[model samples]
Target: MEESTADLIRAQLRRLRSAAGLNQEEFGKLVHYSASMVSAVETGTRPYDRPLLARADEVLASGGLLVSLLRIAEREGQPSWFLPWLDAERLARQLRVFQPTLIPALLQTEGYARAVIRCDDLLSDEEVERRVAARLDRQAILAQPDPPQLIAVVDEAVLHRRDERFRALMVHQVEHLIACAERPNVSIHVIPLSVGLHIGLSGPFSLARGADGGWVAIMENQLTASPTDGEADLATLSARWETVRNEALSRQQSVELLKEVVKSWP
Candidate 1:
């Protein structure tokens, strides 16, 4: 049978325990783990957290090997759906984004990012830090020698929401957007409230022109997201992009609107 990851780790643990010349109870005492906990980990019933793995590494004299193995398991731990979208974003020649409720992740400042990312209850603080670091890492591409053009259109009402929890955060985010808009390759636009219902009211999405000349679209639904490169989906998204862009104020006006919102923050 193919060795499952858990099975492989179980074997490693069992071998390491034997090599250390320690019985289950003795080894558990050394690592400050319960005897049953040790048995379960050896049998692959429980997952290893970093602290336990580190302790095992120290006690087994594995020279950080155990911790290194754990790192491999935790690396690239972004949500599965977001990975493909990130791949496309990294190499896109240009990206056009429509945001209905929050700042685009690429342009968000650290404080703003914290406010936005903290909405999730499923994440521990360490996991939240990992995600935030991952997000900031993605922004590095924007500073490369030949960065992609980023065009963003935000709903005017998104900035106007009186969200007390994120009130100050919104002010900082708006200022960041204005500064980013000044970049030679970036364009910012605002979809006026006067436009009344439109295609953008449906949701937010991004259209990317890849460096290889292919096109892709990324759509963000509540908690999940998806990316599509199929011709038909691209066509539909392209048409939607056009409709939304038409409803947005000119780029110059958008910057002014962004600056205008700063006065409303209390």
Candidate 2:
């Protein structure tokens, strides 16, 4: 089998770190990441993103070599269909998201994301890991110096669903949600079960507003996610977003609800 781009990059990272006589802890400090993150990238359990690569390149004096490999790995790792949405997400100034069944991807913890992706069963282990890494990488935007405002409204059911098998995962996921909600740029709202039914029940979707004031919407289904800049689609999704958001608890209340849900988990 051919060595994947990710595998090659991992090898290069490991080789360079060894040559520098630095352990994972030392290298992680130089790059402003945790030692575990360095290990994960070196072990190929987590995918490397542009930010990590750029940091490593500068710190290791690799002359952009590490950053150069990120493009190739991203092209190979990410599905072509999702590229447009990724671009939009990076460029957007504000994002409005609605998820009826599960926690939105942007706010999901690694364990929860893995559990969610593993549900397909048909995906090979390699593919599942690749996807989980990609999803986590996308989340870096939120940690940027000037992250876009993210308003996420989820159905209360998303928090209430429980299973003995995923009990720990759910607890961690909810805890992560509370942490995210505390960020000034990130707001999480939940539509209580008391609301019964709402327009958002149709599916999960997101609207991204760019600096130029134009809006793009992405709708997700089982097979793929579709991005649209059509006026009609934007108008419809915008209205649905407003409706669901109005039905959701305020940010403070949502945080309280999330805390309550976390306690109820086990």
Which candidate number maximizes TM-score?
A: 2
TM-score of each: 0.70, 0.72
Superposed Cα deviation of residue 5, candidate 2 (Å): 14
Task: Tell me the spans in candidate 2 whose CA falls farther than 4 Å from its real position.
Answer: 1-75
Q: What is the lDDT of residue 223 in candidate 2?
A: 86
Judged by lDDT, which candidate is best? Answer: 2
- The C-alpha lDDT values of all candidates are 0.77, 0.83
Q: Candidate 1 residues 1-266, lDDT tens each? A: 11243355557778888998998999999999878868856764344455677788899998887667544544546544554466567667899988878777888888877766777988799888877877787788788899999988888888786778777877888898899888898998888899888888889899877654667788889878878766888898899889988899998999899888998676
Clashes of each: 0, 0
How does residue 152 of candidate 1 score in lDDT? 85
Clashing pairs in 2: none
Which lDDT tens digits does candidate 2 get at residues 1-266? Answer: 01355567778888888988899999999998789868866874344456677788887778888767656645666654564466668767899999999999999999999999999999999999988988898898899999999999999998876778888888989999999999999999999999998899999999888765667789999888888777898888888988999999999999999999988765
